[model samples]
Target: MHVKYLIIGAGPTGLGAAHRLTELGEHSVLVLERNPYAGGLAASFRDAAGFTWDIGGHVVFSHYTYFDNLVDALLGGEYLEHMRIARVRIAERWVPYPFQNNIRHLPPDMQWECVQALLPGHRREVAPTNFAEWFEYVFGAGIAKYFMRPYNFKVWATPAEMMSYQWIGERVSVVNLEMVLRNLVLQLDNVSWGPNNLFRFPQQGGTGEIFTRLAARLGDKVRLNTPVAAVDPASRAVHTADGQTITYDKLLTTGPLDILIRDQIGAGPAAAMVGDGMRAAAGQLARNGVYVAGVGVNGTRDDDTCWMYFPESNAPFYRLTNFHNYSPRNAARPGHQRALMAETSWSDHKPEQLDTLMDKTIEGLVNTSMLHPDETARIASRWSIAVDYGYPVPTPGRDDALRCIQPWLEAHGIYSRGRFGGWKYEAANMDHSVMQGVEWAGRMVLGEEETTYKL
Candidate 1:
């Protein structure tokens, strides 16, 4: 079988490419998705108890106008506008997010320590090498020690020293000493720092609905349950699990780049040696898997809080999003029940017992007061999903590895574009991933330049 454009993995990126290609009046595009569903990582599920849960904590916020327009066009009025009500559970207190700016909520002694570290002459002159050093340099000892270090470790499943600082731009909240001091003195909440301060979510199915709706427009162009087993870059073809060989003039992959380089791509002895080096370099790129535990409660949840963060070890989850709060319809009976989605990250550095993760997560919710003792009887449903390709941790040499791997793939008429495909946590948000696919289509089909996938 032959196609002009063959796209793999019908996630946001693959769907984005298909949608854009069709919109551009091109009909020679085919999308292959391994799962029976369209949305890969963005897929949502409805439990037996009628609560809807996303793959993880997903909020619809965009950095591009195209993404916004796409989501708007797809979702239309079937979305809920939300004001982000996020918090950090630190020192057993719900401090406003951007914890450094809201240190005043801590005990007086702790506040004094943070302020002292922020003092003008108390700053340390440390040349930043790793994320730890950058955290210390930017957030100072007090803030770093109290929140940044522990929280990031929980989220990344690796020590800050093992990660890089380049992806921290716009993703992290940099504290202003003067503003922090002013907030501390006046006891003001500086919770509005991130781009997701105001966001949107689907009113019906979940975040996954956005992609599913887009995929519906593609119809038979998207082939579900077609898992690519091997890729022959020399022949510009892919062998699927069912023994079908599909040839393409150009291929776009939206899966893990490392997996593609290691298992899929076939090469000669000399190229294999180079591939080994590339694999080693790709291995150096740190990434952590996520266990998403969704707890559906039978009782009413009146709180309007969107999500919250946990820095303490008592909770196995680093972040918890009130899934029902995103949209009341997310819960089975609307005002009668609620859904709580908790996320836990783990890797070789941080191992997790998958079988017991759901139980541990529930106990953690109780420990963190998310699930009260009296509310245990009202537990409607308990489910856990482990996502293999979760957060892509950025290491110092990640960019260099991508720089080498991407050019080689481009030379072979292959484009890896998405969250793990691009390997850029900075631009790996939903919007960026979709735009990467859209731009990849433009580059391949229309001979236009691709922007987001630049290494």
Candidate 2:
């Protein structure tokens, strides 16, 4: 089968690209996915209890108007607006997210110590050499010691010094001292501007609904359970796992671009370069999340709070989500039922030790105060996904390596784009991933100005 564009990896990016193609009346397309359904890692599953669990906790918040327009066009009426009340739990305390900003509630000495770190005079001009240094430069050594350093290390699975600080806008909390003081006095401390600060949730199925809908729109055009073995860009023919050699004019690979290229072409010097291009950063999924477990409690909470984080050495998983608060449907049990989901992460993958991890995670949760040791609640289900490649570790060498190599691939008629495709962790969220695909397609179809994933 010959087509105008042969799209690989039937995730949001690929689906978004296809949508843009179809809207432009360029419908000669074929989407190939290794899985049977669309939505790649963001897909949803129906449990034995008839409740849907998003592969992990996927909370969608759109920063681009184009993205909003597309979602409204696709899943328009089904979307539900949610008021975000995310929090962070640290040192056996329920601190608000952006634990740094709203930390005035601590004991007087602790609060004074934190404030001393935040003083304007203490913040001198120091060009931070690394991510950790940047944190120290901005928040001062005091705050860094209390929360910034260890908490981040737990989450990123790498020392802050090992990573870069470029992706720090809108994502991290910058404490406006005046506002922080006012909130401290008023006792209202929450991350008020997080992208997820206030977002939308699909009334029914989790974030996976968005992709499922997109795939349905593509209909039979989306070929699933068909992993492409090799794509001979020379002849524009793609050989599938089941021996289907389909041809195309141009190929848009949303699969981690370098992997597809490297595997397609054997591991020679060029392939080695391709592999390096693909394996950007620390060559490790930095922010790996282990969903400790989700327990559906029979009763409601004292308050309506969202995801809470812990930034200390004591907690096994750094964060926990009252998944039910995001949407009423997150809970599988009856009305006012509570669903508590937690996560744990590691810097490397050791699949062999996962069975032991299950026991360890349970004990860790109890230790962290997220769960009570004495309370025997019905665990609706206990499951975990390695998340294959969770977060792109943005180390010091990341940007330089990617910049040096991405253009090389393009010279050979390949567009390496997407969270893993381009290998940019900062921009790898669902919105950015979909936009990467759409923008790549625009380049293919209309030769539009490229949207740099970095900026």
Candidate 3:
């Protein structure tokens, strides 16, 4: 009924925070989770046919030594190391991961169009006002049209003009005219541009294995099937759906910041504590939903590709991963079976009919050359999961909103840090999410300044 530190949502951020707090000799900690299991969006599922699938395509490629050490200690030798083999599907051809860097792989006319648009003075010289302008300013009209614009719209489910460009960081591979021309002329493939070129995965379970092990270490410190209905900042108490009230000295919430501020807090007497500016800021935050469809077949393909991006509408899904390649155990039969996982995003800007998504996804696989028409009969299993909070959109007003909301929460002993809680796509990766929690714990216990996430 009481604790020194209380965490909501036993996802990576909450688990990381509790784990770090324990490491700091703080055991009076409790993690409350709404789901029956752990891992949050990073969770995995096993289908009736014995196929393993993640919520979406998640690969373990970290930017922090702390995360690396933690993963190593947890998984030990149970994980498999992999070199990322990412690609893009354009004009019925497989271009390397960075579509702009590998325009040479496109058709002759398309390649020339891209090269012509990148010629001197072809790009805008003015400062970009939004993601749309930013891409055109940096990549020109041809590349933006063929890849950046369409693919981003597909994945984010938001118009480029409505989103901010500050989150680009290392997520996008920026290239110049000279570099593009050199690669085009030299027939070179710039596959090794991003940090995820070398990654790791669980050899047995899906990406959720790491978090499952972490929650196990925390033992009974984590409570599953417990969803918080409201947070009373006045009394520093969390009311669960089942009518139990848990009081805490400090609170770290890993749920959607918008829901926490606008719905949960607004529902109670603490509503008066949240100012109009904070509520308006919460309205500015946006997110997209994702539909993950896993198709298991009786036969296997010998492709070495890890995942492929689809900018064209030929496929209903924006991305597809060869799940079987991540680990042989992911499929029912190691060598004879195949598992293809497709991810389709939706939001107010983009809507999808869920009932027919599976059929469309399979048709997409055939259209994208992942499957044949006759092979549809060989399909043994079809599994799908829909998550409402997929990617957090980095709108133009995100930073300003965070400035208005985060400080107020921190002042009230509430620290929200994670993908949806922080609402920062750039820092929402697995490593960054864990480090945000680790940094928050460090700040709480040792008075160290938080570094991974800053307003």
Candidate 4:
């Protein structure tokens, strides 16, 4: 089989690329997806008990107009727009999102602790060298100690010291002492701080509906259940596990960049072509695993909050989403049930007992006030999935490593993109992932410069 553009993994990136290619009057594009369905990590699944769950917590929010239009065209009137009501569970209180800006909600003593740490002389004046230092440098010791450090550790599953602070773009809300004090003194809530303050969700099918619709538009161009076994960049061909060799003029792989380089390319006949430096750079790339557990209860609550973050050890999960709130159809009984989805991250630095994770997640719900202790028996369904590649850790070496590896892959007419493929958490949002593909297609066909996943 031969194609002008062959994409691996029919996730948002692959589908976006193929769709754009077809839009640009290119018909020889093909997409290969390992899963039986599309959407990749953004995919949703309906459990046997009839509760819908996303891979993690994914909301439809974008930074680009092209992405906005594509989503509007794909989902149309089938989506629900929402004002983000995010919160953080800290010090036995529900502090508003951007915990640093809402410390006034904390206990008097704890509020003073946060304020004292932000005092002129208390904050370090030295330049930050890593994520941990950056937290202290930007948020001061109190906010960093109470929220930034622990919460980041729980989410990334790697010590902040081992990661870089460069990826902190709009993903983090940076606050100065003045803004913090103003909010604290006036008792203002800074909930509308980030890009996702206003987002969208499909009325049904969780987040995967957009991709399902997109893959449908591509027709036979997308091949499901086709996992790539090896890639011979020298020959510009991909060997699938089904024993089919597909050659491509240009290849876009949306799989993990490390696995694509190390397991596929480096282990294939073109191993010598990869060289030692790229392989080592591939090894330097790090990512944590995420376990998503959906707990469906027999009754719904009146809470309007969207999601809550957990930084304390009392909860096994780092974040919990009110899945039922995103779309009532997410629950089996709609208005009568609650779908509580929790996410826990794991890596070598932080090992979790997956076998007991579901139980731990349920216990976490009770600890975080998401569920009543007695409501445990009303649990109708418990569905869980663990993805090995979750958020790609932005280690200090990431940029240098990408500098070393991406150019070589591009030299071989291969573009590895998306969340894990690009290995950039900042650009790993649904919009960014899709736009990365759209930009890749634009660059290939229109000679346009790719902007989303720049090295």
On a 0 to 1 TM-score scale, where does candidate 2 land against the true structure? 0.89
The runs of at least 3 residues in candidate 4 whose Cα sits more than 4 Å from the true structure, single-residue gaps closed, are none
Q: For candidate 4, what is the lDDT?
A: 0.93
Give the alpha carbon lDDT tens digit for every residue of 1-455 in model 2. 78888788889888888888887788898899998879987787656654556665678787788888878877777767777776666656667667777786676677777777777877535799888988778777667877888778767777787888987766687666677677777887656667777677777777788898999998878999999777665565778889888887777777764455457643422344444545552243233434445555566647677677777656566667776676678667635566666666675531225556656666766777656776435455565555645566777776776776566556656566776677777777888888888887787878887674652
Angstrom error at residue 222, model 3: 0.3
Q: Candidate 3: minimum summed lDDT over ten consecutive residues — where?
A: 266-275
C-alpha lDDT score of every prediction, in listed order: 0.87, 0.70, 0.93, 0.93
Model 1: per-residue Cα lDDT over 1-455, one tens digit each? 99989999999999999888888888998998899998888999888878888989899998899999999999987899998998888777788887888898998898888888877777667679999998778878888888898899999998889888977889998878999889977878888889999999999999999998999989999999999888888778888988899999889999998888877873421235345667777776678999999999988756778999998899999999998889998888898887999999999999999889998999988898888989988899997789877988998889889988888888888989899888888888888888988888787668998777677
Instruction: Predict model 2's lDDT versus the native.
Output: 0.70
Query: Where does candidate 1 stray beyond 4 Å?
Result: 266-274
- The estimated TM-scores of all candidates read 0.97, 0.89, 0.99, 0.99
TM-score, candidate number 4: 0.99
lDDT of 3 by residue, 53-77 (tens): 9999999998899999999999997
In candidate 2, list every pair of residues with a backbone clash: 88-309, 290-344
Give the winner by lDDT: 1 or 2.
Answer: 1
lDDT of 4 at 48: 98
TM-score, structure 3 vs. true: 0.99
